[model samples]
Target: MGIEIEQKILGHARDAHPHECCGLLLGRGGRIEQIRPAANVHREPATHFEIDPQALLDAHRAARDGGPQVLGYYHSHPTTLPEPSATDRARAAGDGSIWAIVGEGRVTWWRDEKDGFAPLPYALRDG
Candidate 1:
């Protein structure tokens, strides 16, 4: 379940970096969510990812069409690790948000926990 989400995000992140890539989260039940690219705002996509507010809202609305909410947001740390950077920590995608940090051309996801972002490292599990 987790691994699939990471893979989906990784694909978008790698392709979207060094600009921030965003998308709607799709899935059934509460597992197997997929990341689908929306649109990015940052024109200088080399070291920063800028998401348009309208685009994000649109994505969220679209997800509702599929029975899911925003589920938080994701962006990439180009040429870096999947680990969250200081910026990522300071301006996290919100407390309950799911942060997907894609680097090394891969994806690693974290869930917002009271202790802060907890790694939900991509893994495959049988349904």
Candidate 2:
């Protein structure tokens, strides 16, 4: 992932303010190349996020059409800490996908493994 992507995620998180924002990460081999913003269709957008199902489907379809792979997801914590919340833990699928949580202008990366969410180290590259 690039620092530029982190900056974009932080900016989206800030723009979302009290509401959580969600998006899909398009990438390859664990490296994120792009962030596609999606609608947070959760009933309580302030505290939770559910990426719009249609958007998710479209992304998958695009990937089938030779687009970037759907590598992971990103979300924001408007006023809370950057770490994953209890709600996040409960909802995680444990599929070993990357999850980025943005808060306070910073982003924390995690891997949703079978056991739990584990911290992931990543380099911020310049484009």
Best by TM-score: 2
| Model 2 regions lying over 4 Å from their true place | none
Per-model root-mean-square deviation over C-alphas:
3.1, 0.8
Q: State the lDDT of candidate 1 residue by residue for 26-57, as single tens digits.
A: 55554546665767666666666666778777
lDDT score, candidate 2, position 8: 89
Candidate 2 local Cα displacement, residue 99, angstroms: 0.1
Model 1: lowest-lDDT 10 consecutive positions: 23-32
TM-score of 2: 0.97
lDDT of 2 by residue, 1-127 (tens): 8888988888888888789999998998778999999999999999899999999999999999999999899999988888989999999999999999988778999999999899999899997
Candidates' C-alpha lDDT: 0.67, 0.91
